[model samples]
Target: MSTVKMISLRVKSMKNIQKIVKTMKVVSAAKYAKAKKDLLVARPYGTSTKVFYDKLDLKDPQEQTLLIAITSDRGLCGALHKNVSTKIKEEFAKRPENSKIVCVGEKSRGLLQGQYGKSFLGVADQIGRKPPTFLDASRISNILFTTPYKYTSGKIIFNESKSVVSYLTSVVSVFTLRTLNAAPGLRVYDSLDDDLLQSYLEFSVTSLVFYALKEAAASEQSSRVNAMDQASKTAGNMISELTMVLNKTRQAAITTELIEIISGATAAKKDSGV
Candidate 1:
């Protein structure tokens, strides 16, 4: 009986968990759809900017390097955050002394806190609670501009959404205003002024950040949806298995009770000579 009760309890608990997992899957699916739509709309801006920057033929700067990791505070989203953090860790390993990290989300900070705490320049939290906006990107870009630690060349690490169930960890190049000004291809532009270039740099940063945020957001949602779906399926299987066990145990218990009752009645009848 105790075994039967335990199995029954397990089945009930698993059913409840499955319900939560299904609910989470539904919510993540909705968010993924929106994120994917937004990413499609924003792709052009990021691509065009990247193409224009590439045409400048900018030389990789030899000075301090910056790394901006785009992640979220939330977990249970598969390897979305881990992918970005792992890439950043590789970069940091290469240049531990010169690399500085600007974590666009708290997850990166948390992941890299122990070993590379000193390398973190700033962190932006409360990300992914809502869809990322241009304002959010602008705020993150401002951290780069206002921070005392300056960097000449950098990379933005993020997870790029490929499909409903897949993503690619990608890196985008970044250059400081000074480095951009010194690009060999800058000679092609006849009369670009300092103020104009500064504005362009600021805009570029914001655009890049915006693009990364959208990609990361979409990837996170998709990963989360898939994760929850898997969890729900596993929970469902466990519930079914446990329920089966409970039924078998219950049947055995009933069989034993009936057998005992039959034996007692037969003994009484025999003793009474009936």
Candidate 2:
């Protein structure tokens, strides 16, 4: 009976937990769908922005590098952001004495701040509070171009959403003044003034940044959906096993009671016959 009670309690708790996990899984799927739409809207802009990189490659590469990590404010996405953070650490390790880290979301900021200390260039938390937009991405992109920091190379690290259930932790490069100037087709845009070149850089960076943000968001939700689904299944299996145990234990208890009653009746009959 005690065993039955314990197992029953566990099964009850698991049932409630399964309910919560199932609800969370559904929410994550909805969020993932929304993020996919956002990515579709932003892809063309990112692709068109690449034209700037072709015409204006920078000649001077900076001694220090900048690492930009795209992450999210909320967790429960398994290791999606953690993978990006690990990549950031790997890139930081490769850099020489001078390098800067830029965090796009709360997760990266929290993870990197402890390890990198003062090495962080800045953190953009509020940008990803809602679904990423062109305006938001433009602000972050503008800062990178207008900032006086002489970073030669910049890399954006993110979880690329490959499909509903697949994602890749990937890194992409942002061109510097030197890289853009050395681009293969420099002669075509050579006539354009410095202002035009700056404008191009802004467009390229904004589109790329926005795309990264949306993709990372999509990856975050998708990963959570998958994880929660697996958790729910595991919980359900556990509940079913415990229920079986409870039933068997109940049957055993009832059988023992029946045996005791029959033994008492047999003894009473023997006494009466005497």
Candidate 3:
């Protein structure tokens, strides 16, 4: 019933809230650590696949360019999904107007749907939590091969700039496939033997699909790690704020009790004629 008691209750509530936030922060940090590790392990494989694809001289104009846009199914990862979506959009902008987009995550699908509409081929959910197995890779590869992308031949375009390629190569040389032959109007299918060309096309398409999945997995993990880190930081801040509030409430209660004591003493003195 007392003001002090009410204030104490509030302090207790704040402390409880602070405890929850602290726990959440710890959990997020642990998840982030695991995600970071996953990303590191998969980095090399993704890079090598990309490098191998770059070496093939596919210069045919009639070839359909398939853009496998990778992103997270969820959105708690800071600007990771946004950044990827932006990168995809920029890549799309550079294309010759009829590029096909195959999204790997729900986030990517949702973001690109309004813009690309029917051009969006399909979506794969939860592609980031686990390391992509060959089965997973095969599913994506099959999708690419069976889809209209193969039937419609064109140049394959990567969104990354030259600087990015250079940076990646310098850091992870083994993963770097090779310098991409960016020569415009270069014909690709001409150099291959008939059966080899078909095989190469199939392999190339599969490789691209595999690379995309790998990259998507890496990116998603990285994004989640970053998100968890930020969540941890935000939780820390909330705890701090709650602590301050608890302190303030405690102080207010203490001041109220002192005031009541002083008032009682004054009343006694007046009644005693002192």
Per-residue lDDT of 1-274 in model 3, one digit per residue for the tens? 3454565565566557656645654654565455445545555655665564456543334334556665656666555556666766775677646667767667878887898867776666766555655666666656665664443442222222122111111111111111122333224425634566446555655555455455444444444455555555665676576566667777877888999999999999999996
Q: For every model shown, what is its TM-score relative to the native structure? A: 0.95, 0.84, 0.67
**Predicted model with the maximum lDDT:** 1
RMSD of each: 1.5, 3.0, 6.7
Which ranges in model 2 have alpha carbons more than 4 Å from their true place?
54-62, 127-129, 142-148, 178-184, 252-274
Cα deviation of 142 in candidate 1 (Å)? 0.6
Where does candidate 1 have its weakest 10-residue lDDT segment? 1-10
Residue ranges of candidate 1 with Cα displaced over 4 Å = none
Cα deviation at 122, candidate 3, in Å, is 1.9
| Top candidate (TM-score) | 1
Candidates ranked by lDDT, best first? 1, 2, 3
* lDDT per residue as tens, model 1, 1-274: 4688788878888999999999999999999999999999989989998997889988987789999999998888887898888999998888788999999788888898888888888999989899999999999999988988878988999998999989999999888888988888988988889999898888998899999999999999999999999999899889888888888999999999999999999999999997
lDDT of 2 by residue, 108-127 (tens): 88888887968877777785
